[model samples]
Target: MPANESTNSPLDTLWRVHAILWMVVAGEGLAVVLALATETSSDRLTYFGRLSVAIQWVMLLTLVAIYALRKPLSRIRPQGVAYVALCLLLINTWVTAGIAWLLMRDVGPMPAGGWQALVLRLTGIVLAVGLLGLAAFQNHWRARQAAVQAKQAQLESLHSRIRPHFLFNTLNTGVALVRRRPEEVERLLLDLADLFRAALAGPRQISLEDELALARRYLEIEALRFGDRLSVRWELPGVMPAVTVPALSIQPLVENAIRHGVEQLPAGGEVEIAVSTTPGTVVVRITNPLPHPGSHSHPGHRVGLNASQVRIEALTDGRGSVQTQVAGGRYIATVRLPVGT
Candidate 1:
């Protein structure tokens, strides 16, 4: 990985704030213990307590500045989260120490003036904050490294699941149809090939034009197998090229409509496919006629429904969801995904 990638994630900034606070607290505790052991002066406890609180206030003020700005830097470098933290460290440490020294102006190395005391205070602040930044950046790098590793594992899992489960069943259906009525088999097989190509392709997103083409092919194959038993309708856009969607997202729902919806109802039913978009999201709804609970046939049990849910969830980074319910004797599964990642 490039060094700059490590310079970007926010998790490191979180840890740096936390670690600095803990070290300052621990250092105060150690100073108190030493004073007691060495018989340095009971009055010194007051100085340690005041310095610790002042340093902590500086850290807290820096955090408040971070939250208030919220844009990483006020302007110029929007991506400079690390640089902001470093600036906060230097300023907070220097300012907090300067204030603490003012309160105890008569004590320590600089008995001359407040400005002289301010310089001495900066020394500890600089050392402590500098060291803390180093530790935090290491953690940021490791966490991102781990994220890359986990993503590889997930892609491999998707690779295994990518084999078309429905294809085996689909081809079998085509073979049976060919044995009984061979004329439509060639047309059906071509459609099947196109559908498989869509599944195997690796683009993260696809144009709706391609999705409609693929969905149409899959629908044609079902139409061949089911004959007059399947009724399909599309509420697609007039300008098809204006739309795009996550690859294969629409078809699996369509497959589920066939497996659990159309194929389940022997007397036949209507399957409706539609897509629309809102300000920051895309909506796809698949609705099909419902059968009496026990009277319905499940295509390969409930595997299709279960698998589609898992696959969509994985692809969306948890921003998308699928919900299934029966309303007015119609089974509806609507999927919602954020418009852009």
Candidate 2:
């Protein structure tokens, strides 16, 4: 599975703003229901005020406990996590109800069944709500997991299609070199083997530095075919941050630069690869000159660029992007990845 496919526990979901809002709404609804069920017309307002405090206290304390233990709970099975959350809810309900009972005893007379009965009634309500919430969370989680799996399967399929195209391109480079540059053919084949190995390794992430190295090897092989017509300018940061990107992500874009851009121009052009970083993002840009109008440039299908875009977006959980544009007679492809992902 891709690293980004890992699902968060239900406890994590509870910490989200929308989830918290829903909890507050549900708690208010429960308070209203309890007020109507147990209190007389005259005492309903007073009973609601006290019940609201108790319910909110129970909900808040239970949420806090879950938040504090979220990391540990994430390691356990989903069913076990649900069970633990319900246990915490029950415990908090009893503790909050006991405190409310003692504090309100001197304030007024007890209801028909007294504090003990109130506690029991509160426990039943807590259990029912807790079970219902858990069931809803489990269903939501399963749906999310299924969607992630489907996206991953689609990403893997795209990756598999990309590999053959890369392999065939590199082999063609090697075949060209074998006729006139027999000595260089051995080195070309070795580089081709390394590049293919990485491509064939299946869906996984590679360090930014490692991915750049692979792109360099690919360019080296292409250089053997294009000769002096192909020149590369690399602008790298002084220190490369520790970042991981989908494997083969950068290489394909570089290949596109050579095939569709430099290879079409008569006096070939420079391929500029620039890597820069912001506080929370790493950006890579590849720029190559566009062929002149009426030049023998074949229409590009953009298969590699599209595949790279999908893989990057999927791997980064939509936090990263691959974009391309044409400006100043140059075809520019840019990739942005979120830092510390």
Candidate 3:
């Protein structure tokens, strides 16, 4: 998904160039027999062979160009890629075979039923295979690159939604303490800083223990503002998976619960977060009261929570997911993470 990756890797391109053009040379040798069999003028057939040899070089340049033009190549449709590959295959074979026959003229006729004729036959076959292989693989790699790019784009869009959602909720909470006691501003500022730090950490991968520590830090900050109104129930047991997950994965769910589910209610409510490993999977669940009967939401009430869920699925390639349900005036969100990931 990175810019440099999409573009041709210079090292790889160099290797392919060195490696693949030999297929053309090998194909040209096969053209020798075709040249001997054809009735066309020797000069004309030789010219055609030379042209085919020239075309192989053009193909090498084209492949290099394809690598250099990384973005557009991935955007190419599957069928279009197939068409291109087929065209290249045919063209290289036609051109190289003709050139081989022409070049072989000076070398003398193939000895009938002898080792010389056998060598020419084998060389032709090898060239055909090599050219076909290159075309097939080129299309496959392009398709793979396109898929990866699309997935990365989806992940970025999901992560982009997080900053605004968290900021809105945190600032709203800060405004409450401001009216009653402005002196709490400094302490609140520190909490806000910690919250943002957890939010903006690098990379989508981190250890599970680190994610939990971050979630706890975030909850501690929120607890200062909410006082006893917000309570935490951590149900993590012995031996947690050390696998990586999106950074600060659990905090947003708890934060969302505190902001929209519990903070609005007069009695407040408890936020229960539990994590445990089962076989090859690790599960984390957070539960909070609905604040009132018949509680429901659309988007804005839980954007931060949704962002985290989207990110987890993206990072895990659907190996992880979040399940949510409202039961008995309580909203519950469960996250399933693959331990093997």
Per-prediction CA RMSD (Å): 7.9, 3.1, 11.4
Order the numbered candidates by lDDT, best leading: 2, 3, 1
Q: Which residues of candidate 3, in runs, are more than 4 Å off? A: 1-137, 178-187, 294-302
Q: Model 1: residues >4 Å from true position, as ranges?
A: 1-148, 240-246, 299-315
Instruction: Pick the winner on TM-score between candidates 2 and 3.
Output: 2
Clashing pairs in 3: 49-98, 49-99, 52-95
Worst 10 residues of 2 by lDDT: 1-10
Runs of candidate 2 exceeding 4 Å displacement? 1-5, 8-56, 102-113, 294-296
Query: What lDDT does the true structure give each of the candidates?
Result: 0.65, 0.85, 0.66
Task: List model 1 lDDT by residue over 1-341, tens digit each.
Answer: 11122234453344465656675675566446544544333466765665457655766777777767665354434236556666776777677666756776576544344566546645654556556765776576678667656654654454345445666767777888798789877898788788777666653556656866777888888888888899898886565435445566567678778877778776878899887777876677899987667874644544545544554555554556778888988889887766553
Span of ten consecutive residues with least summed lDDT in model 1: 1-10
Query: lDDT (0-100) at residue 241 of candidate 2?
Result: 72
Pull out the clashing pairs in model 2: none
TM-score for all models, in order of appearance? 0.62, 0.85, 0.57
Per-residue lDDT tens digits of candidate 2, residues 163-259?
Answer: 8988889988888999879988778878888898898888889899999999999999999999999999999999987888889989999999998
